[model samples]
Target: MKYLVMVQGTQADYEGMRGKPSPGSPAWSEAELAAMYAYMGAISNDLSETGELVDAQGLAEPARTRLVTAGEDGKPVITDGPYSETKELMAGYWVLECESLERVTEIAARVTRCPGPEGITDYPVVIRPILDGAGDI
Candidate 1:
């Protein structure tokens, strides 16, 4: 089975990445940031070696996003983001071929433990099975 794992980020998360310290919040030091990247790279390499990694990518800032909807007259309505009050935005995603949903969930759990701002280890990782062929769909 193939699964998609998504990491969520918020505005505060983006600010932290930009070295902007939130009120009473500690900025991520260069070494910490390096360690975070290293950890992610290591895991990706491991998955690749195991032949489970299908694809992985980190997204650009959500501020660059655009939302399109149908207008009253059937025209397009476009809105630029970074939407205020949004709970979270998709920060990155990984597609992995695993034996089962449990395996994917385990991978997601490990990803959530990857180092982040202020040494936090509680990031959310959403996982969903990928429907491939027409029969699966």
Candidate 2:
């Protein structure tokens, strides 16, 4: 089955990391940055080696995001970020073709070990099975 792993973060968590400088800055210690990169690299490499990684990517900053709404005339309107009222926002995702949901769960568990820049950790990964046959039409 194909699964999509959604990476989500709370508003407080998102804002906490916002406007931060680049990873290599003096404000970000080398050890911290290395841990983050190493964790991500390891997951990517493992998935690639196993041929389970369909797609994966980190998203750009939320500030660059925009929202579109439809007017009464069915036209679209553009707006800024923070589109939803939920505390958690999706940061990125990975689509994986795994044998079962258990396997996807295992992968999410492994990703949770990755360390953030400030030694903060968020189990932001969510796994859901894809329903390809939902629309028979």
Candidate 3:
């Protein structure tokens, strides 16, 4: 079965992420950045070895996002976006093909242990199984 692990955070968290110094900035330091990358890489490697990892990627900042909607007249309307008023915004995600929901949960648990930005750990990753078209709507 295929699962998608969605990473979500609050609007406050997302806003706070904007214009914050890059990890490599003199105030931030490269060593800290390197460590985070190393930890993520290790997890990726381990997943690959276990043959469960399908794909994963970090996303660009949310401010660059564009929102599209259908107008009353049914024309497309475009606007700048973080897209929604909700507190939660999806940060990134991973697609995994695993043997069972239990296995997917296990992988999510492991990923939750990985380091996050600013040395403050974050484990808001959410795992859900992909639904096929054959299932009831």
Write model 1 residue lDDT over 1-137, tens digit each, in one string. Answer: 88989988776666677687764334677887898789888888999999999999988888888999999999999999989878688888889999988888888888878875663425578998899887986
Which parts of model 3 have CA positions greater than 4 angstroms off? 10-29, 117-123
Best by TM-score: 1
Please list the residue runs of candidate 1 whose C-alpha ends up more than 4 Å from where it truly belongs after superposition. Answer: 23-26, 119-121, 133-137
Candidate 2, residue 94: CA error in Å?
Answer: 1.1
Global lDDT of each model?
0.82, 0.72, 0.67
- What order do candidates take by lDDT, descending? 1, 2, 3
In candidate 3 the C-alpha lDDT for residue 62 amounts to: 62
Q: Against the true structure, what is each candidate's TM-score?
A: 0.88, 0.77, 0.75
For model 2, how does the per-residue alpha-carbon lDDT over 14-55 read when each residue is reduced to its tens digit? 444543443232234567667767888789889989999999
Ranking of all candidate structures by their TM-score, best first: 1, 2, 3
Q: 3-107, model 3: which lDDT tens digit per residue?
A: 898876544444444434432322224565566568777877887888878898876656677788999999999988565675556767778888989988887
Judging by TM-score, tell me the better candidate of 1 and 2: 1
Worst 10 contiguous positions by lDDT, candidate 3: 19-28
Q: Indicate the residue-level lDDT of 96 in model 3.
A: 84
Better TM-score candidate (1, 3): 1
